[model samples]
Target: MKKIRIQCALLTALSFLMGLSQFIIVGILNNLSNSFHTSIDHVGVLVTLFAIVYAIMTPIINLSVGHAPLYKVLIILFSIFAIGNMLTAVANNFNILLLSRLLTALASGPSMSIAITLAAAITPPQKRSWIVSWVFSGFSIASVFGVPIGTWISDNLNWRFLFWIIFILSIILIAILYRLLPHNLRQKKGHGFLRQLAIFKNTHIILGILIPIFNFSAVYIVYTYLKPLLINKLGFSTNNVITILFLYGLCGLISNQISGHINNRKWTKTLVSFLSVQAGSLFILFLTSNFKWLSLIAILFMALTMSVQNSPVELYYMEIAEQKYPQSLVLASSFDSIFSNVGVAIGSAAGGYTVNTLGLGYLGLIGGIFSVLAISVLLILNKVYFQ
Candidate 1:
């Protein structure tokens, strides 16, 4: 247990860097565009490109490397990730910066998938969900806190400093992972890429992959334009908006921590309850837009439930995969990451469309509709499968 905990912590750090590096781009997009002599929109595409690459590349990489020596694969992937960060820092033009992001995204998806796989492989069945959730919370933590810190650093120092920090942190994690991960955990008889693709044949697995997309589309529909929703719609000043965001992030971090301890045996109920409240929060946000205190409450509730859905849903995937597709455990992790990226992209785009068409205040109402759609999917999943 002690050794597994240490490995989990180290893997958590790796996951944190993955989240940090991905999101830090948003913080410094203008800086990057200025440095590269391009449009901010072009630089923003780096974010979209990174997600697309990660979503597309992860399963492809996993088909081949799934059964390789785990720690060694991590080392190689982390090395690529660190070097990509370094390349980004030293990039002279937009093309080089884009290349760096592509390399990192390619490595990041598989690296995180492998980390989650190892987390599951090393732990007992009963604790696997908790461990995976713990690992993923690192990403949540990075999103809540790291992005702001990176933005602040960019404001105070150089924008490249963010990647420098990530590169240095990743280097430290390499040594920790080497020292912590058990050497004997690798398997040689895992499924090939084509065989892993067979998971799509399983209806439950497809639904599982789409779950994040549904849930995230709900959350990010409002969250993507959160600042505007808070200011233009809810009438918050800039500093108060930051404070509200901070509170929301704190709720998210706490929610992720709580998610790690949830009972998987009742995951259907757990998922439904959280998703219901998630939908309710958006509903409340939609209704209470004019009431400052009520609006803040809705925002906090939204943040709290946004991440609490992770562990149970992940547990559901592992349980389903373990029972139906034992050889595709790592592939499940890759799918999780891949689907999550797709979710964010879809949600952001949808939110942008809603703001343009219906208006910003209507974001929560539309987001509520998305969450309700997710709830409908989960209910059908439970009735058809879990029962």
Candidate 2:
């Protein structure tokens, strides 16, 4: 158990770097704009580009490398990741910086999918979800700690320095992974890339992927626009809002930790309850928009339920792949990462439309609708499949 925990911890650190690399851009957009002599709006494209590339590249890379030993594939991907960061730090122009980001995005997706696969490979069946939850926490931890620290570094030092830090850390992780992962780990028999695509035809696989899409879309609908809502509607001062955002992130971290212990036998009820609470809290935020403290509590409650579905849903995909589609394990593991980006896009667009059409106060109402939709999907999945 101790050894399993250590391996998961290391993989969590790998996830932290990947998450930090992807999200830290939001905090340093101004720095990037200033350094590259471009508009902040233009620099914002970097975020969109990274997401698109990551979503498109993950399964492709997984398919390409499915036959390779997991350890070697991880090392190779991390090495490319290190190079991407290095390129980001040294880029002299906006185009070069964009290129660097593309390079990093290409590596980031596959690294995470493979890391989850490696975690499952190393751990026992009973503990796979626990280990996978730890892996997911890496991104939560990054949002909670790493992005803020990177923002601080950008404020005090230079944005380039932050990538340098990532580069150095990636190098360290590569060395650790090379030494830590077992070389003799069995590789599942490879299916042709076209053959693996057949998994998507399975109703269970498609619905399993949609759960994240709807749930994440629900969370991001309000979350993506939270700072604006806090300032424009909730009447928080800018400085206090930063603290509140940090507190909200801590709630997310706690959410992930709590999710790790959820048992599979009880997952259907647990997932439904969590999503129900999430929907209710969003509605509470809607009702309490005029009441400052109550609105704040509702927002935190939403955060608390935000990640409850992640571990169980991901564990479901991993288990399904292991039992029914072992050859597509890496491809299956990549689904959450890929679709979650799609959800972000959908939610952000929906939130923007709502804000333009209705107002900030209605963001919660819109988000709650999506949460309810997620619940509907879960019910369908349960009745048709789990039962």
Candidate 3:
């Protein structure tokens, strides 16, 4: 029993670290650009590289590390994460920083995928949703606290210190995981990488993968350039901008918890309702950028929709994975991470271009259109495949 408790804690901590590593860039972009003597566009490459590497590596790692003991795999991955964070702290050149980011991304794919797999492994079938939600809540928490704290550290000290802080935390998490997680637990044979890839031949798997692509693209389109939009177009003070982001994060945290509880009860209706709300939120953001208070409200709603959408989408894919290739569920999660990161990179690139060319406010409009399109696709998919 105590061992199980420790496993849960370690998994949640790893989840938190994975999320913080991914998003800490959002709050430190200006500092990074200035310190590196580059433009924000150049700094954006860090995010792009991270996402691209994460997308490309997820499936490859899962395939290569087939049926390994869970503890051993986690130890190896977390050590890589620790090394990556330490390198980022001391990186002196832009190229080295980019390399460190790639290393971190490489580590992140397995760490996050394994965390989810572990949660599912330990929980009873009836409680799987709760466990998955508990694990993913780490991301929501990171959004609320990690971004703000990272921003504070970057502002008050050198940006290098932010990585150092995470590095220290990684060390502690590694120690806890080594001590607490079970050593004998192994992957089921059916989940071997090859079998997982084969499952993608199914139409449901294809649609499941595409849903994340569209959903994340819509979210990232506005999210990638949010700081600039808030400061330049919305006329928000830096402090206010941070505060609004915090609010957005908080709303997301609440929504994650709520969605986890409600998903098993009315999965389909919950998804449609949340997607509709997201569409509405994006439209509101497009129309109300000039009004500071209104924009804040819109962002809160957007956060709510995003948080609600994440778990259901994941659960949807997991269910399809179970039916088609039960053993390869972990591989499915890895694929999800890869595809989702691809979406993030594409969306960020698209959003960056649209903001530069069309106007920053246009980002919300673009995102809304994609959200609507994603919903339409899902509806069609549901009618044909799901039903």
Which regions of candidate 2 are displaced past 4 Å? 28-45, 90-97, 231-235, 286-292, 352-360
Model 2 residue 212 distance off true place after TM-score fit, in angstroms: 0.6
Candidates 2 and 3, the one with greater TM-score:
3
**RMSD in angstroms, candidate 2?**
2.7
In lDDT terms, how accurate is model 2? Answer: 0.82
Q: lDDT tens string, model 1, 1-387? A: 888888888899899999889867755655676777875445556766787788888878877775678789889999999999999999888888899999999999999988988888888987877788889888878867886677567756788888988999999889878887888777446556677667789888777776777788788777666655776687887556545655766787888887887865656667788889989999998888888789779878888877776777776776676777777777776676787777767766677677777887777888888888788877887887767
Q: How many residue pairs clash in each candidate?
A: 0, 0, 1
> How much is 112 displaced in model 3, in angstroms?
0.6
Maximum-TM-score candidate: 3
C-alpha lDDT of residue 52 in model 3:
88
For all predicted structures, in order, the TM-scores are 0.89, 0.89, 0.95
lDDT of 1 at 259: 83
Q: Evaluate model 1: give its TM-score.
A: 0.89
Error of 1 at 21 (Å): 1.5
Question: Which of 1 and 3 is the better model by TM-score?
Answer: 3
Candidate 2 positional error at 276, Å: 1.8
Error of 2 at 239 (Å): 3.5
